[model samples]
Target: MSKRTAIIDIGSNSARLVIFEKTSRYGFHLICEQKSKVRIGEAAYEKEGYLQPIGIKRAYFTLKSFLHTIDKYQANKTLCIATSALRDAPNGKEFVQWIQKELGLSIKVIDGNKEAKYGGIAAVNLLPISEGISIDIGGGSSDMTLIKHGYIVDTYSLDLGTVRLKELFFDKGVNPSEINEKAKAYIQHELEKLPEHFRHTLAIGIGGTARTLSKGIMKQVAYPLDKLHAFTYNVSEHRSYLDAIPLSSAKNLKRFGLKKNRYDTIREGTLIFNEILSHIGTETVISSAAGVREGVYLEQLLKKDNLKFPSRINPSVTSILDRFQPLVNIQKNQKTKRKLASNLYTVLQQDINDNKQYEKELLWAVKLSSIGQTLTVYRSHQHAFYIAMQELNHGFTHEEILLISFLLRMNEKELLNKPLFTHYKPLLPEKSTLLWLSFIYTLTVLLQEASNNAGITFTYTNKTLRIISDKPLYLAKEKVKALEKPIPFAIIIEDESTLPKNKKLGI
Candidate 1:
């Protein structure tokens, strides 16, 4: 794979270009992305699927502009794939050849199965989902893939989409009731083509319709985090709103917290999405920021690695660490902190209740604890917290991401910030669990800093925490004495060799 690669996805509703820069093998991030609402299948659906001049002109110009942006970035390689729009169009091949002849670009027209597989690959690799049906609803087709145990098991595509339905029913200017009744029956008829096995309780939503709905739900519920990827909501809770979208008038979309740009196709998209969810027995929806573009990139990037990232490797985390913590010693130091934190957590596990469950998050927090120090030493905790909140995005749930942020934000003076905690309280673990993890993480970091990277051990008994070190931890004793405890507990520091013991009073 090239060091810098650009992926172009031409869909019925839009054409998008994304540039990804690799920092390491299996470590990459999006450097730039551009999209145009070409609606290439604009009037083609009603004309026996013939590419019309209006939509063809829009797509041709969009692709031309995209190439300019790709050249500006000097992307080493470019891969372009066209989805439902081009595949369903009678002149799709002519358009592809025309682009090759004129703009020196080649576009691969993928069938519905390939489109669904791409979506599945992206969702499985990027989102924290093992089993679900990845749905990519476009302007002319609804592609789906069944993912189980981190692999795509099956894929299928239906001749149902927003633009297809809009042109078939909505644009006819029929009354909303009659249009919806006709659209629902038509959608159901198309959904019957889906494989009987393409059902799951969780749905991985890909593309614009899913994202728009997720954003609106976030606004409706006042979700704190501004992120769209991996944002999850229960279908039963929002079923009414989903059903109401297609019936909403253009002027009333704002009540659902929708943007005007999406007003053109949001209704049809929502109708298709809602019907599909019901058909597949979907209970939850996890929105994905990645789709065919990312899938196309990853398919090529991980071709040698079985089309999946190596086990236990998260691309986002690897990319951040590769960029920020380049030195071996700094990485070694993080490892050292992780070891100490793990040891402390084990010793104190019996007393912290179910906090043992958060040990994974604790380890990740420890690994990334020092990244902010590279930016500035003063108040690095806040910097680390912000970075974790933003960069620890892919392959992580919202709760896990928020928990890691709170862990990274730990400081000696404060165990937990009240305002910050209160703001994201709903997305976090219980107060007790968070405080325990924070206490353990903060103590481990303090010990490593004060001991000058010396060996350490821990043993907790009878409501007292005992830390034994290979050398005298003089700085550690004072820090421990002034530390804030999550619960009523005592901490004692012991020097390994001979000397009067330094008695540290626990707070």
Candidate 2:
């Protein structure tokens, strides 16, 4: 356990604060969060690109509330940052200073490039973006970052946002051809300014614009809420959908299923997205739920750890996995055991079933758990756990990494357990853990195939476990320990040294 921290992101269209529960001495939890659509970019871009007094007041009020929330949580540290809206405003600095004085909240107004970086870093934390561009179209500006192999190669903030376009062109809600023309020109100019080397085969979407579109798609198709995670959309289909949502009623539009609050900005967001696609010649979009706030969270982790990024990877994942790398060791030895354990808990699925992805995740854990061991020797289990959690750089949730490590530990001990391992029971319930543990706590002698490491062999007979052997059983003793745990159960060991007879040994 570690101190909790709070992060506040003041974007062009909205403001939000999330309290991240620090998991390890350095890990973070997206414990809880709150958001509001303040339209600061609308205010900034409306009056010749200056922060309007009204917008400033709105932001001040929002920050005041966020500060109270953080205070309520007893968070030890806080950071507030403003993006495109403030960068476009002449009075942005003054507004920040005012907030600093009025609510005792210091706000840092960052430029567009930094905003893009934060967005890209957050995306990298979720899915590996091998090569792509990220576009976050806000109320007043669109941020673009070119990423190749998980690194930010270039960034540009274009002065083209949904609110700004609506204000500049849609006089009395008319589709001003000139506005569209200017938007295209602005986007093209910004794109041209980007390094020619940054063109990508893929594109990642972040910010409110992309998020709102994903929600709209979900509403349009009646998608189930559960798989709303990392949703993917075709650029053309999204563009067509945006085209269907006529411009006039965009602000007060009623799309039946979607939240009313998000209606106004979607049109503008869609327009900007279409233009970005045109500029980059990309027809793909991967929407990410994580953005600057998570980036801020990752930044805090790296700074605290003093961890260096591998020359190849974004430092964000490095800092993240450093706290969870110990869990990958038992992937091979514990999987079938895990599957056996999982089988025992099938009847309980009425209460706690897993997703289709869960088993794959478990299998992945089994394969990767022992990656650190040069050989399957005495301390290999311990070495494997260390490598999985500490040496590996695979981007995973801190919780996921820890859970895998906890499962890996199940394969090493005799009598099926250790005390520190119990902390997991609260998270993974007793039935599930025991089933997984019992399956893993299998004797190699009884399951003779595993003795010569010929291969892993497993079978169960109404609470009894067995393994077929390929060698003499004398060397099978140490391997038996991994198979014997949480007992008052049954065990059987057979070897050629024992005169070719089926035997039974129960403990």
Candidate 3:
């Protein structure tokens, strides 16, 4: 029997539950994740910075749902933590007592510093190659942590986050100058406590505020899937963009391409964001998809000395192949197609390996491009493409998942007139992204050859890729036309006796 553990994070703005199921291998898989945007901080700010009964009621409901989930999963252990809004409330202790007595759920109200610590642990899980300051901008507060050599160096939690900032600054209808004066002073005072060693470090950000900023950049450049995960934006670039927006209405903000729900709060969010960046002399903001709840999971993981803290997501494509094996009869063909893509991946690792994630997602899409046949036999390529792009989930963030799905949905023709993923282009280096996607697509169609029975083997060198195959009458000539697009290297096809002139293919 396996043990399942659950963690509930009841924050000021949103409440979340993350469950981990430990299998026989002793590694835990993310079993379920859910959140409720209860806006607890809104009420806390309204009732003179205290949580109102209405807000508590809504939060209790959310916590009850989490309880049901834990019961359903048969979880043996559960941990619950509440931050900023609850800690600040006069009746917060009573609230915790109320939950324990009424719902039979134990809870802990974590201080700002501890919140910073757990958020740091979670950020450590996400950024394996980075040593930096981790930030989680919650609805009520922003938790900051400095990590070096896998140990927490410094930590803080400021009363500045999306919900709290919006309530205290923007939502009050205060003029921009007055708001900036108050928030800037608060932030500057908070920064005085940060150790000097953390200054100018890479800023790793977690939560909605960070993701909202990332999505805007994604939509701006049409940044494809690969760039979305570890995408970096410096303070200057982000500040200028935020400065231009009025942040009054979603429509006014839509021109910036942020989600409608984000615009009302993002102005204050960005202000606090820029303030922290300037205070710490941060070089860049690395958006981390995991946050508090993941930290709760990591805490349990760390206790066993088998810490996967510094978590790295396998390329979406590789993760899918490893987890969801292709259907029965087609499994063999899928394996061949994957091996073929891997061969190309090995050949081009030099010019293309800046991001293994983008490559893995592409090749993974290619491998399963044939999996949609369970629905019907006809037009499986379209089905497969749709499924690969739209349906698959590899714990991808909202933006990256969207980019991957969009890339899969696009076609060669779609590539010609302003590509669908073009919105994210400005945020990323184009040559690497376009090259990765295009090569993966080309290799996919080549290997599938429209699912023919022909035997083919390809040998790859730094400059060229060689294919040996006997032409089968079953495939369409247009299948070869897919490779006619402009590519840098050459592809040559050799016959059994090596008789036909070596074909030189151009990108």
Candidate 4:
């Protein structure tokens, strides 16, 4: 049976509730999410570091409504965590006690180090990054975690955040130049206290500030894809826009297509972010939509299994399969197709100049090729392409997703060309390489469906390729010939029984 869980993250800037439905052990999807800009840290920075009455009231109402959602979904578990705002406040613990007494809810207040650790965990487990520094800029504090070899190596939390900085300098109506100099000086001083070893070339940005910045950049560049999780940019390439943000007025910011509510703190957030990038000597920044909420859910799930992290499980693939598996019964066939496709790819590697970089994507295409059969057998390949493009949300770069979808959309004798190819040309591999992968996938599926056997083998030369199977090859041979028109080489299919018993086909 499936399970559902809810995680409530009450940060300095906003209170959010995310409900996740677990269709399988490690396969889950976001069912519903709610965010309220309660600004729980509003005026707390200037008000002697106490949880302000208005802020507390806003948080209370947000949580009360979130509880109604938990009851609606019947979430099996609920985790409420408070970050810098609550943890740094003088009356933070007092507020937690009151919430427990009045709202019947228990909130776990985590320190800075723990918050950094959770953010790091979310990045390493979800994003395709192994070595980088994750910067999560919250409303009250910024957390930095140094990750090496897929583990958190060091963590540092600075009292530099959007709300905090805005309260200290920007709200005073200081000129842009003075505000910039003062903020930079303070940021540099705090960052200098950390060890020099924390510097890295890649920086992963989390939290609202990072997400909003990525969206603004995407709009400026007219990026084709609307996805935000893996949106990336070169710091040097976009430095001009980053430099202009602090000086831009609210109207100017809105002209840049920023949300109205985000205008107040975006300037402060951008200044802090640009300073961090400069200090760390980072060249690239990848935006991550997952943060404290995802990290908290993962921590709880892993604890139940007594494991720290999943052992080589792709969360995106698992989640997709969990949702569509009941509609399709092709697991065994999918495995057979993948094996056969891999063997064929190996045999043709020499002729195709294979770099083996796309091997994983080819296998993914094989496993998901038949998913479209659930909807209808007519134009199933097109259906599969649509499903993959729209539904495969995590654990893949934009390029990989497009490549996989394009391969699934291939029909016999179709080669990638202009207009259609131009849309994703920047992210795609060479045309010849894509064609070879598409052919391999098509041939494998056709042969596997035609024959019932434990294994199939292949042999290839510059001019021709041969398929050797233990079973009769009459039907398989016909399909192979029909689909061989796009390939440069001819194909021959033969029964393995015709050969000597001592001979073995290359796999």
Which scores better on TM-score, 1 or 4? 1
Best candidate, TM-score-wise?
1
lDDT (10s digit) by residue, model 3, range 10-86: 88778889887764332455778888887776756766777776788899899888899999988889999898888
Global Cα lDDT for candidate 3? 0.66
Candidate 2 lDDT, tens digit per residue, 233-352? 677766767655534354445753446776666665666787677767787777777777877776666654332233444332333344443453233444444453344334223333
Error of 2 at 238 (Å): 4.3
Candidate 1 local lDDT, residue 309: 93
lDDT of each: 0.89, 0.60, 0.66, 0.83
Supply the TM-score for candidate 4: 0.92
Expressed as tens digits, the lDDT of each residue in 1-507 for candidate 1 is 799999999999999999999999889999999989999999898889999999889988999999999999999999999988888888889999999998999999999999999999899999999999999989989999999999999999999888998999999974787899999999999888887998899999998999999999999999988899999999999988999999987778889998788999999999999999999999999999998888889999899989999887989889878876636436568778989988888888787867478888889988887778878889989988998888888899999999998988988898899999999999998888788889999998888878877777788889988887767798778779999999998887777543345633221
TM-score of 1: 0.96
Tell me the TM-score of each prediction against the true structure: 0.96, 0.65, 0.68, 0.92
Give me the runs in candidate 1 sitting further than 4 Å from their true place.
326-329, 496-507
Worst 10 residues of 4 by lDDT: 303-312
Off by over 4 Å in 2: 175-192, 222-225, 237-239, 246-248, 251-257, 303-360, 365-466, 469-507
Residue 131 of model 2 has an lDDT of 66
